[model samples]
Target: MTPPPPSTGQPGPATRRTVLRALAALPASALALGAAPGLLTTATAAAPARGYATRYTVVPFLDSSDAGVSVYQSDDATDFRLIKAAAYTPPANRVRDASVLKHTDGRYYLTYTTHTWQDTSTTIGFARSTDLVNWTFLYDYTVPIMNLSRAWAPEWFVDGDGSVNVLVSCSTTADEWTFTPYRLKAADSALTSWSAPVALSGIGANHIDTFVVRAGSTYHAFTKNETTKYIEYATAAALTGPYTFRGTGDWAGWGGTREGPALVQLDNGAWRIFFDGYGDGSYYYSDSYDTFATWSAPAKLPAVSGTVRHFTVLKETVTGGPTLPTGVTRSFRSANYTTRYWQEQSALVNLPVVGSASTTAEKQAATFTIVAGLADSGGCSFRNAAGNYLRHYDFRARFDAHDGTSTFAADATFVLRAGASSGSVRLESYNYPGRYLRHYDYQLRVDAADGTDLFRQDSSFAAVTAWA
Candidate 1:
């Protein structure tokens, strides 16, 4: 089946037939990667500490404009939703290809391209944030490059020695794409001062969006080969060095016309690389279990694909945050699909459009009493109209009479999280910490979080007036 047009970051117009058709046509490889089809869910029996976040915050630019900088967050890298839109638009400058880093001073800092590709720029923009949401403009630190035509895609890299640096793509020729990576070191802890620009060796001109991460004694670099548009991999012993580039063309199977490669390490120690498939106007992320030696085929970033342009993600652990409320009879409204609500059908949960035309029975099916968790007090359980509870059976969400078993209690209970989107909430399975209560093809299920934009929005719900 032909896939539907990409979502416009709003409630989609997918009907049941289109959804089922799309599901039926999903590739086996996609199914294997949890991209949707039959159940590919995993229920690992372990939970993280309550009220702390091992969070992944994505800072992506919608475009090279004043309203471009936006912030998104996810529990499992696969599911991301917006935390703040236009979180910070730099004063009098366009924000593009932005990178974020939590500095040692307990503040978040941003580095980005100050102008569009059509304009000549010599400075990279900067900003500081106490929380990831609000921002204060710092300064547009000029790149110390002679006859610089543009300084683009400034990525933040903290060295092994605890020094901060920005890897920027520099070009001296106007209207030409020929560019090379340069290292700009922060001269002071305030990040207001920087050292002279030093050209990186071996990675010659025409390479851009260079993101570097040091593992052990080697620095692994992922840069876009401008000519081929394939994200190439390179390694060096030093920060600025004679690097070796491999997997030149189609080496990793992430097709060409990709750029702005950013990487973040998962809690499980695996790596995920995100890039823009500009040729098709999509954002794709690929995972590597054994580092960059191998990679899973790139998958679209659900709600974010076709929306955000070049971006980067920052992973951090948040502690002592807010907790979920109990004893509230509330109805859950889908974040992305505003008119939809969580409703029960034949003892199974689904996200269906709940509106005034529906009968009283239809409203009750969409209502649930949020109560203290049967398994863990820190979490919550959804109890429905007939006194049955919502639980995951074989990874599928179903409403059933409580069996009074420990496993049933655990399966029914979920840890509440501040939603990826503002004023929303995410339900993390109590037994499978990283897994969440989300809808796949409109059917409710407990699935492992894979770090997709779709997963992020599907798992996020807003507590609203009870439908009953």
Candidate 2:
């Protein structure tokens, strides 16, 4: 491992809470974009074209009682729910401000702070995982900064040149609560070695939790302003550069006391930024349709607000992964609303009444081949008579041709859980763990189980004799 260059400085003493909170509210120093965890490939490719299927894996810091990171998955970025509560907890370290990257070798790498806000340290921890749930300790790396009070909030940044880097906020003086952004470049693709730390220029001191993304030739950085307590914006021509702050002190319209600004591009070419509202203990996100110039009002992340802190989100595009079996046909009859049956018309899946007077086409539309799940064979995929698959797009169930992508496979596959009612089975979404295939207003859609009898009955279906 390459030793980071040494620097001269002197230390002072201060409480960890003040230093960490001040650093959290610090301003932008520098930024860069890195691959989000859960991606199976190594290529740092650009975002997929609009309409392509994608999955977003979110890692956030849970409250103090949970002392580790939690993992969440979402189809639409807005509705993120817990996938694992204890995704990665460092052995003797706190997983504060954890950043994830799926390396080229197809393993998930996590870089996080080694201590809580009460202790000062110059080292950050690293871990690796094959599956996002299980992680193995890699090593603890000490930043080579002399008299460093704290090295906090390490975030992975992949430059446009394909070089991997980590942006860390370092405070030299202990009592003053001053922090400046510094970065260490990965010396190799394995990320086991790193170059010396260098301070980011133009983005002066007192900024923390800086997250960056690239759009064309421009680099956009969203960082917190420690002094003003608002997330600010800056841009640079190069990755490690003279970043000029374009917006500061409420320029983005989000109120103060926000930190940990993380950005990810949506499948529709739009941009979304997630930030920590430490003051109110809520997590909020805002969308930008026209780059970073204008943003919608911040909205609390449903079910995620007040639950997590200082997190990062990784979006991975999947193709040709996850498969299903094609075999016997079956029909689904609604358990609660026995008169209605799962039917397809004009490519949409819905619950409609089917009786002896129903036509042959109606009967055929209601019947489907119960194939082994496209994503997980343990589950099942429904195939229509015309060779189309019953899949959920934008959370709505429909009959669409197989796209041979992992997203399609996951959307199409439904795990057969024991029915909410006796002798009935509820179709749970393979990708979204707690969500099930249910009918809302007679339209088939995947919704989270709300623990109500109506929801249980709506999601439960009985396998009747094939109508076709």
On TM-score, the candidate that comes out on top is 2
Give the per-residue lDDT digits (tens) of candidate 1, residues 212-304: 777778877787765565788888889887899967888888888677777776543456688777667678887675658877667787567
Pairs of residues at least 3 apart in sequence or in different chains that clash in candidate 2 = 25-226, 26-207, 26-226, 27-206, 27-207, 33-158, 42-104, 229-257, 323-374
Model 2 C-alpha lDDT per residue in residues 1-468, reported as the tens digit of each score: 111111112332232223444555444332211111110111232323222335678777765442678888764465575888887877886767778887778998888877765567678889999978888889999989888767877888777667888888877644325677787899988898999988777776766667778788877777776666678888888766689999988987888867778887754345778877767777887767577887767777767776666667777865522222348777889988898999998999889999889999999999998887777665678889889999887778999999888768877877655555776777766655456789899989988665456777888888878899
Candidate 1 positional error at 458, Å: 7.7
- TM-scores vs. true structure, each candidate: 0.65, 0.66
Relative to the true structure, candidate 2 reaches a TM of: 0.66
State the displacement of the C-alpha of residue 124, model 2, in Å, after optimal TM-score superposition. 0.9
The global C-alpha lDDT for each of the candidates, from Candidate 1 onward, is 0.72, 0.71
Cα lDDT, model 1, residue 374: 83
Q: Report model 1's TM-score to 2 decimal places.
A: 0.65
